[model samples]
Target chain A: MKILLYIILVTILLATSSARYGVVAQQSKVREYRIANEHRILEEFVTLLSIPNVASDHVNIRRNAALIIEMMRRRGLEPRLLEAGNSVPPAIYGEWKVPGATRTIILYAHYDGQPTDPKQWAGTMPWQPTLRSAALEAGGTILSMPKPGEKIDPEWRLYARSASDDKAGVMAILTAVDALKAQGIAPTSNVKFFFEGEEEAGSSHLGDIIRDQKLLEADAWLICDGPVHQSGLKQVVFGVRGDTNVDLTVYGAKRPLHSGHYGNWSPNPGLILAKLLSSMKDEAGRVTIAGWYDDVAPLGETERRAIEEAPHYDNELKTQLGLARTENAGKSLLELINEPSLNINGMSSGDVGALARNVIPTTASAVLDLRLVKGT
Target chain B: MKILLYIILVTILLATSSARYGVVAQQSKVREYRIANEHRILEEFVTLLSIPNVASDHVNIRRNAALIIEMMRRRGLEPRLLEAGNSVPPAIYGEWKVPGATRTIILYAHYDGQPTDPKQWAGTMPWQPTLRSAALEAGGTILSMPKPGEKIDPEWRLYARSASDDKAGVMAILTAVDALKAQGIAPTSNVKFFFEGEEEAGSSHLGDIIRDQKLLEADAWLICDGPVHQSGLKQVVFGVRGDTNVDLTVYGAKRPLHSGHYGNWSPNPGLILAKLLSSMKDEAGRVTIAGWYDDVAPLGETERRAIEEAPHYDNELKTQLGLARTENAGKSLLELINEPSLNINGMSSGDVGALARNVIPTTASAVLDLRLVKGT
Candidate 1:
């Protein structure tokens, strides 16, 4: 947790370097504080990780929000829950004001985690944080938490659902503020901490929450989510594609029919659905839907330059993922993400396995996920 | 039961007339026998229908075969069970020999019924034969079975699974023989009885049973199955489309992944299946699979004439079936039946209804049923 805080703060510090020497001194002070208080920081993070934070899980998610609010209060940030409605998970709003601060930076993170099935996890449960000497893939053996005077390895891994997702962002952002306060750093921009509780649930109520609360007025928002660069540097994404989903269904006869007596005579809903879905994309993995790409705005000069300068790591990604080829039509991942995309999230009809019977199903359905660029 | 037997025997007699006067006389004698022995014949049929004859229900199917064999024994036909190995329903074989007969005709029918869900039946169960004063759709009222010496209404509907399918064939064919014997009339041709026990399950083991027994040698097989013509004259179909089934499955990533994180980068199995299935047919509902219709044999002059003379009931059928348009490129249902066909029996991937989530499925699958005419 201490090491994670240093990396997140380093990313923020590197981006806002008004003076190189002054930033280096502040970085050293934060590092010194983190090292001195490693046990306490790790314990606080472990406490946070112990709580189940699935956004839709109302009771446990509320418990998670309460714990984080208390953690913020301990840091003297005057934390408050910015509720979006009765059922929606509330964002934790807090501020650290500095004397004579010129600008305000909203340090953004999320406290919620993805919905996970416990059985899918390897040798561990999703909410139970287990410390490992290294990654599980690297033959790491589980170990107990270190005693106060015992040595704690910064390289040790923690296994849990949100141990590395937005929960780590929450931990890192809070610990960074703790380190800054302890080191007595002064004359920096006032930092407004905004820890969202529903980012993993696609943050459907995010805009409503921000508008309703009116507490996000700031110079810039620094999101402490997503992965670092593949080259092992902090990745600072300029923008991300907008994501949304749609459900599709096609009908056939009102009731299931014997395929032999009917077959081609009565329409098969599965075939109808198949034809419909297939018409949306071509053989080259490009969408053929009429005017699908028409509304997409082209990349700006700086955006094009940024894509060009990004690492040529497509092959590395493919290799790591055990894929022989990719859906590439003279484009890289960085360039392709700038456009729109359509994907079948899921689909179903009658049955496919042992329970499958020889009857034409009445209906077929699918869930489609669409990623949009600027206009589309 | 009495009226059904009369129509079936009339159809048989009408097709095999050496002299029109002789057939008419025999038909009257058969009608007299049925009229007098209606109660006994109905009792025997009810006993057969009471056994749940779903082809896959091992115990019940065998009970049906056993009951049929006993019925043949009561008629002194020297009945025997032609066992089709363990785990397969057995066919019941019996014969009646006429001295000086130059030809033998096999009366073919199936005792086994389709796999039926009783809940779908209206006001009745699949195995419980229920009598109604009229058709169920015409506001039929449930009626008790007639007492001994009471008048029987021949037009009353007897509802049960396989009541109109091949089980009715079994009853009509068997009762016809009883009528002939009771009236002291000998068939011009020697008759062989072949009551199949597993026609509804695609008869996968039928060839093995026939080859193993070698008891099916005959001049002709008169299969008492299918429906009467739309014009209500007893129908005679020269041939039917041969049916077969195939299961299909398509691949995707090894595990479910978040659509936002993976989406277009990972190929969705549902889309792959959709594209593959769509490639099989076009807008006019003709299969586009390469060489799909290459082996189909053309109809002869007699078959072509028969189709032309057959009622053009396509429009009526469409209206009855609640369809605005039929898949008619330029041909009728009769003409299309003469060609091979491909249909999706069923298909599935991931969740489609309430449980559908934003994850790319691991696999997609479909069951295809192909119908063949003469060659294809």
Candidate 2:
């Protein structure tokens, strides 16, 4: 009993000491400020998410930009719209200059989201910003937004099309600035905000926007996109894989033929596409295309070490994902991510389930997304 | 000029001799009858095609049965409905008894058609029975129905869901009877007409109906359904492949995940399914499954000779289909059809084209059709 007490006392003393100095001290201060204004931050986020912001939706996308500008203006930062030309969704730009700061950090986030079919969404609509007790897949129930005096649960998720993808990034960055101001904490570096409006449309005008805006130049860029780690842990990804999409279509007959009458005689486009795709990748998940891996650059020492040091959570992930086995049996996920990959974003031929008919479709199509590493 | 005249005279004489004693003589009588009452026959066919005869639509299916019964009665034959139980779609039965005949032949056709989606139909509605100059795929234009004095083109096609499938069978059979009676030609065999109302629903109660109806017994059954030969030549199929459908689905994460964040890490269901299906067949279009071809019955000497004697129109077919190559490279389509085959009737994973989102879908599914030969 005496030893246990002693151990507890030592733990408390060490924690208290760490709270007074080091990264823990800074984190504690940020947390306190965030907790104090969590409700307001969440409400603002909900409002932002309620806007329909598909990149190709010109009217709604402009609305998103206007609202984001208002969000920056409320913080006393003068925001401007950066556009390539007329009718294009503009980038919202703002900056906070710190006196005596030697570096300028550009914070990047996108406002537009991927196009979604309304019929594909579950009970909630894409732009409705429905709050759920948890994830919908986890039997989450919709909850009414909290009133002014009510406390909120951090675990509750706001369900919307871009709730997690990029709107969350914008919300988090803006909230972090609010927290710093509320706590009277000064940032060591000048921060510039660059909220993009057409990332989902492949950022076609991003180069022009950057080239035309001279003030956007910074020492380094901190991009806030993607999701939290699959293990629900915070992670920092230094480099992102470059993406290229290819739309592939295979042809069968000129018209759909009854499967029973001409199945074997007619070439099935779906099977042809499958065979073509299979030829590109082997059973071990390695791509077999000629010259596919030839141009890949060797990993640097730092990258190699980082991969080796990363957690070995494949077993835990497999259990959570309900997978008995993964492709490329023995390779770790950290090891796999560093390599180039060929993934099928979407594939279709005829129809399945209730809409399925016994017809050999005229064409089968697949959208393949190739994620390139540093070299290829 | 004298030599040309002599050649023409010889050609005319030979053609007349062949028409008098060859297959043309048998076809000439049917042709004369069809040509005499073409307008009425076409109008009757259009009226029958106008009825929605999806087997599941009980009211429409019964209406089809009643109309068919009326048609048989008009020809002075006794007609009745054969049913297993109440509320089920019944088979329309009618018979023409030939005195002193040693054989009875049953002419089988179905009134019910495959369920159709109105939106999937081109130009014409499922039961509207519109006339077209050609197939919709061949850029056919909708044409007005012929008036009493208007000349009808034999090449013109009637467009409806079941226009050519089985309704055409019903119309042709009845018209043949009319032609025979008008020409004072008697059929040697006692002809029995059996029109099923639920063929598209797998003829679930056909066995029961046959067992309950004593007059259904016949020495021969001539089934009139399916398409004309791909070569547009009259052909008969002696045996049909037994069909079995298997639905296959592969799993990914429990919910959709951003492809950018977890693409390489998360096993994509589409890719997994593609790999699985690819494993079933080789590059040469031969199934690699352990027992896929093991149980296939070998073709007899007669069947082999028949296949060899069939017209080799594969080159013309390939050109029409815009195919540079076919599966099982050197083998003829006739040889391939004799073997049991596997085909993907339909497959789906997420959405393609504009509706496609950058997410790894939860599941990918495929409808696989396996065509079986004897002993398989």
TM-score of candidate 2 to 2 decimals: 0.88
Instruction: Tell me each candidate's TM-score.
Output: 0.72, 0.88
- Please identify model 2 stretches exceeding 4 Å from their true place: A1-39, B1-26, B53-63, B73-77, B84-89, B115-117, B181-186
lDDT of 2 by residue, B185-221 (tens): 6677788989998777667888999998789899977
For model 1, the superposed segments whose C-alpha errors exceed 4 Å read A1-81, A87-204, A222-234, B1-202, B222-234
- For candidate 2, the docking band is acceptable
Q: For each candidate, C-alpha RMSD in Å?
A: 6.8, 7.2
lDDT of 2 at A176: 70
Q: How accurate is candidate 1 locally (lDDT)?
A: 0.78
| DockQ of candidate 1, scored on C-alphas against the true complex (2 decimals) | 0.33
Clash counts for all predictions:
0, 0
The CAPRI quality class of candidate 1 comes to acceptable
